[model samples]
Target: MSSTDTGARRGRPPQTPEQAEEVRARIVGATARVFTRVGSRGLSVAQIIEEAGLARPTFYRYFANAVEPLHAVLTASNAGLVGGITSALTGTDEPVELGIALIDAYLDWARGHGPMLRPLFAELHDPASPVSAYREAAFDDIRAAVRGTFTELGRPVPSPLDLDAALHVCEYVVYRISAEAGPGAQPDPETVAAARLTMIRVLLTTLGTRADVEYALEVPGLFPPPGDD
Candidate 1:
C-alpha cells in the first residue's frame, strides 16, 4: 500500500469533542488550500483528503462534500475581514482618512489571506456555491460599514456615491488587481500594495468629495515615493 493508505490505516483512537473540532478545522483549512489552488470547478475530494492528511472515513465524518468545508472557510473568512474593516474605520472622521484606513485594512487582510481570497473571489459568482451567499452577505456588511463611516463623520453621502454600487466597484477593483498582479505576476509586495492604494484613490474620487481626493493624494504613505516607483 502507498504511504497515504498506510497512514489512513493507522488512524488514531476515537476523538473527543475538542479533538474532533480540531480535525474539522484542519479539514476546512486544507479544503481552502485546495480550493484556492484549483477553484471549486476543479476541486476534488481526493485532493482535499490528501492535503488534509486525513483518512477518507475521518473526512466523511465531518463533511458530506467538499462544498461544506468551503462554506465554513468562506463564512469564517468573511466575518474576520468585515470585523477588521469595521475596526479600522472606527474613530476616523475625515473622509480621506477614512478612505485610507479602509483601504489599508483591506490590503492588510488581502495580504494575510491572499491564498484563500484569490479563489474565493474567483468563485464568488457561482450561484450554486455556498460562497455566493456568503459573498452577498459580506457586501451588505461592507455597505453598512461604509455608510456608518459617513454617518459618524456627519457627512451626507454624495449623489454620485451609491453605497451598494460603490461596494461592488470596490470589490471588483480589488479582486481584478489582485488576480492580475498575484503570485506569478512577478510584482513585489510593495509594488502591489502601491497599486492597490492608487486604485483606492481612484475609488475615493468617485465616492468621496474633491477635497477627500486631494487629501488622499497628499497622504505620505498612501503610495510609494516618486523615486521608488
Candidate 2:
C-alpha cells in the first residue's frame, strides 16, 4: 500500500496523553506551515497529511476535518496574544503609557509569530475560514481587558464600539504593513515603525481622554522617540 494509507498498518496508537498531544502538535505545526506557504486558499487535508508525515487515518484520529487544525492553531494564538495584551495593561497605569504598552504587546506577538501572523491577518475576511468567529471573540477579550484597566484607574471605559473600531484600525494597518511580504516574512523596519505610530494615534484617540492624548502628543521622546522610525 501507498504511504498515504499505511499509518494503521505501521505503528501503535499513542499510549500516553503526552504522545497524543505531541502528535496533535505536529499536525497543527504542519497546518501553520501550509498557511505560511499557501495561505488558507491552498490549505487542505491532503496537504496537511503530507506535510505532517501522517496517513489519512492517523490525521483523522485527532481531527475531524481540514479546518479543525487551522482552528486549533488560531485558538492557541488568540490565547497568547490576548494574554500578552492583558499583561501589558497590568504593568502600567498612565493612560498614554497604557496605549504604548498595548501596541507594543501586539507588535511583539506579531513579530514572534511571524510565520503565522500574515496568514492570520489574511484570514480575517476569509468567509470559509473559522477565523471570523475566533477573531471576534479575541477582540472582545481585549476589549474586556481594556475596560478592566480603565475601571481600575477610576477612568471611564471607552465604549465597546469605540474600542473595537480602534483595534480594527490597527488590524488594518498591520495588514497593510505585512501584505506585500511573502509568508513567513516580516515587514521592514520602516514599515513596522510607521504602522506602530499610526496604530498608537488611533488607539489614543479612541481610548484616551482629550488631555491624555494632548499629553501624548507633547511628550518629546516617549511618543515617537528616536529609533521608533
Candidate 3:
C-alpha cells in the first residue's frame, strides 16, 4: 500500500496544527473514559483505541503508550483544580468563608467529572504518578497564594509547616468524601455540607488564630456547625 492509500483509509489526515490538536484532544477524551471504566492501573492502549474508535497505528501516531494520554488528561485536571482554587479564594479574606468556598469548589470539580473523579482522586497520594506531581505543584501554588492573601490582609503569615498541614488536612477530608461516594455520581448535598464543615473546622482551627476561630463560632450561622449537617 502507498502513503496515499494509508492516508485515505485513516480518514483524512489532520491538515493543520489545530486539526492535529483536535485529534489529540479526542484521544485524551477517550483515555479519560477508559480510565473511568477501568481506573488507571488497568487501563491499556487497546482500551483507548476501542474507546476512540481509532486504529492501532493511529493511536500510536498520537501517543507513545497508553499512559501518555493519561498525562494529558491529568494535565487538564491540574489546570482546572488550580484555576478553581484561584476563583474560589479570590475575594475572600475571612477564614471560615475561604475554607468553605474552597471545599465547595473542589467538590464541584469532582461532581463535574463524575466517575472520572475516582481515579484522579486516587492518584493524588501516589507519589510516582503524574497526578501526584501535579497535585504537589498545585498545592505549592495555592500555598503561595495563601501567603499573598495574608500579606494583602496585613496579617502575619502562617509558618510553612502550618500551611502545608492545613492544606493536607483539608485534602484528606475531600479524599475521604470522594471515597465514600458512588463512582458514577457526586456526593449528595448533605454529604457535601458535612465535608464543608469538616474542612472549615480544620482550616480555622489549624491555620487561624484563636480569635478567628472564636469569631467564626460567634457569628450566627456564619459557618454552619457539624450539628446542622
Candidate 4:
C-alpha cells in the first residue's frame, strides 16, 4: 500500500503529543526562513514547503496557511527572548540587577534574531497586512508579563509607567544599545544593572510608586522561583 493509503486504512494511527509537536516545530522553523526571505506579503505555502523539504500537499496537515505557522514561529521566538536572560539574574539582591538582566536578555535575543525578525516586522507593519495581529499578540504577552510582575510586587496597578510603557522604553534601550554598541560590544553587568535601575527610578518618579511596586511583585513571575512555575 502507498504510505498515505496505509496510514489512511489504519483508521488514522495515533501520534504521541510529543511526536506531533516535533513535526509542528519543524514546520515552524522552516517557515521562519521562508518568511524572512519573502516578507509577509510575498509568503506562500509552496515557498514554505520548498524550504521545509516537505511534500506540498502535506503542508496542510500541519498548517492551514502560511500565516498560521508564522504566528507559531513568532510566539516561540518571543518566549525564547524571555527565557534567555532569566538565568543570569541570580545572585543579585538589588532590583536594578533584575532590570539589567532583562535588558541584557533583550539585546542578546535581538542581535540573534534580527535578520528573521527585521523582515517579519516590515511585513507585519505594512498598512494592508493581516500579520499585524501576530505582532500585536506578541507585544500584549510581553506587556502582560511585565504588568503581572509589578502587580505581584505589591505596586499600584496603574501608573504612567506601567509594564506596557516600560516595555517600549526597555525595547528602545535594547535596540539602541545593540545598534550603537556594535555586534562585538559585550555588556558590563554592573553598569547595565545600574543604568537600568536609574532608568527605573526615573520612570517611577515620573509615573509613581505603582510601577516599582509592580516590578517587585511581578519579578517572580518574570523569573520564576526555583523548581516552581
Number of the top-ranking candidate, with TM-score as the measure: 2
Candidate 4 wrongly placed segments (more than 4 Å): 1-22, 82-93, 127-131, 156-163, 173-229
Instruction: State every prediction's TM-score relative to the real structure.
Output: 0.80, 0.87, 0.85, 0.60
Kindly list the per-residue Cα lDDT of model 3 for residues 1-229, writing each as its tens digit: 6443432345455777876787788789999999888777888998997787777887787899999999888878877877887788775877667767777777677667777877777878887777788788888888887888778877788899888888888777777777788677767788877877777777787778888888888766546556754
lDDT of each: 0.74, 0.84, 0.78, 0.59
* Per-model tally of clashing residue pairs: 0, 0, 0, 9
Candidate 2 achieves a global lDDT of 0.84
Tens-digit per-residue lDDT, 111-137, candidate 1: 677666677777778897677899889
lDDT of 2 by residue, 27-82 (tens): 99999888778877788999998898877777889999878998888898899889
Model 4 lDDT tens row, 1-229 = 7554422222232267765566667678888887767777788888887776566656777789988888787677767765564443443434545555656666567657755645644555556665566556666655555556556655455453565576666655544444444343544555555546545544444434554556654654333256655
* Top candidate when judged by lDDT against the true structure: 2
What candidate 2 gets wrong by more than 4 Å, as runs, is 1-11, 222-229
172 in model 3: Cα distance from truth in Å?
A: 1.6
The number of residue pairs in model 4 that clash at the backbone is: 9
Residue pairs with backbone atoms closer than 3 Å in model 2 (clashes): none
**Which ranking of candidates, highest lDDT first?**
2, 3, 1, 4
Ranking by TM-score: 2, 3, 1, 4
Give the CA lDDT, 0 to 100, for residue 167 in model 4.
Answer: 65
